[model samples]
Target: MSAPRNTAGHALVHGWKWLDGFASFFGAVVGGFYKIPGTRPIKTLLHGTWPLGHPLHPMITDLTIGGYTATVAVDVLYLITREPGVGHAADVLIVASFLTSLLSIVSGLTDWNSTYSEERRTGMLHGLLMVVASLGFIASIWLRVAGAEQRDLAIAVGIVAWLVLIVSSYFGGEMVFGYGTEVNRQAWATPPTKWERLDLSESSLDDRKPVVVKAKSGYPVFVVKLDGTVYAMGNTCTHAGGPLNEGKWVGGDRCEIECPWHASRFCVKDAKVHGGPATFSEVRFEVRAAEGRIEVRAR
Candidate 1:
């Protein structure tokens, strides 16, 4: 179902559809950087794949947004009270906002690198708006630092930055609430609870190659054999619903399955996410060789 069209947010995202070309081009450039050798660890850390097991961008954004919001509020107080200390507090908040926004931009770029199509476009628009706001705030800080005479102009710039931040936040919401970006692909999956036979027989399967099979529940299962052991998990990737069966086995030591769409990796044995853009783990299942066929059930 589409989101409600009655709101101005819907209009804003839809009206900006012309920006898709630029978004795609810029996203590809960022995507290429992450694909470079020796960048996986840094990308994975920014993705918050291992320790946090969730996207780091959204978490850090809270601090960035809060700092800017506080700055706006304090600026308003300065206008009302005309207290020198109140104006100084606003300046400090702007500086803090600028610093946190830099972290937000880095983490946001890491997450945005994997997006495609409409999600990519919306994300790029959101990111660009944030960059502009950051720049505006930086200018505001410089003005404030220059002298007391420029304080009023600095507050005006800070207010403009806050407004842009609000608009960008709306697009960010559209990406999540509308496009389901960063959402668990199998969040609503129903794994078979009973022994469900697979369509393929034992002899037809190949080692380290993923095969997609459907259970009695109609949910897709990814089946693979490695080192004489059979493993089964959700066939749909938790990141973007990419077919896991189409991806290749990666990490000689880790034994991970890398999603073809975004390179998200999940451990073959436990289905834990070993790399991201994927924050959630694939749902694992119990499998067995029975009557010349492989059968699986929910664990």
Candidate 2:
């Protein structure tokens, strides 16, 4: 991305550009972490659980931030009211937030790997901000665990860290709302309300190759013939709108197709995503043959 010209928005623009560089460097490092063996279980535990139909990262992040905010509030009350119990609770929460953040970082990174180029740039910046905030909290935790005198310093550091984390969360929000990360593939799609007939005859169904057919409402659907059964799904790839009809069959799987642009794989039978880059499943349609003609309907 080229640097924009100096204007009313120059400072904001340049600040993001600098952050883009930092994110690129930091993402390069996280990419290396993938090389460490025995990471599958961790990926499954963090990403497989879709709390509230959203990725685990943001939910975990909200919980972690909530814990941090509670710890900060507890620290303030402990100082003002001279409650030893409050101080102890704050320490426990600080550690708890740190623990939850580990899973949040992992899940976020897993999703980030599949983000679009523009969103990934912001994703990395959000990650870097969290990293800095983590360091502050980790430092504060060390001091809090050391005892009473260090507790004052811990509170000071923790308050600052909590504020930093809130800002980081804003960037994270931008990645989703502003950039459409992890959103449903067909959220904006306007598929036909009623079933539409496809020109292909039932007897002419071919295996492993995809054909694009327009639905009654004009949404392009990817129709693939596999053995005797026919599969139909939205032609657009869920990840970035790459045309699925133009994509290729995933090797070894006749019922699956891979997006040519990003290689996001979708199962033809039900349009379920077995692999991603694409966190969302492909938009599928009900396909059947009636009176020798093939028809597809939005599901």
* Top-lDDT candidate index: 1
Model 1 agreement with the true structure over 117-175: per-residue lDDT tens digits: 55676788898898888888988999999999998899999899889999898888777
Which model scores highest in TM-score?
A: 1
Screening candidate 1 with a backbone cut-off below 3 angstroms (N, C-alpha, C), the clashing residue pairs are none
lDDT of each: 0.84, 0.76
Assess the local accuracy of residue 50 in candidate 1 as a C-alpha lDDT between 0 and 100.
69
Over 116-164, each residue of candidate 2 has an lDDT whose tens digit, in order, gives: 4556667777788899999999999999878888888999999999999
TM-score for each candidate, following the candidate numbering = 0.90, 0.85
Candidate 2 Cα misplacement greater than 4 A, ranges: 1-15, 32-46, 49-54, 199-205, 251-253, 290-292
Misplaced by over 4 Å in model 1 are 1-18
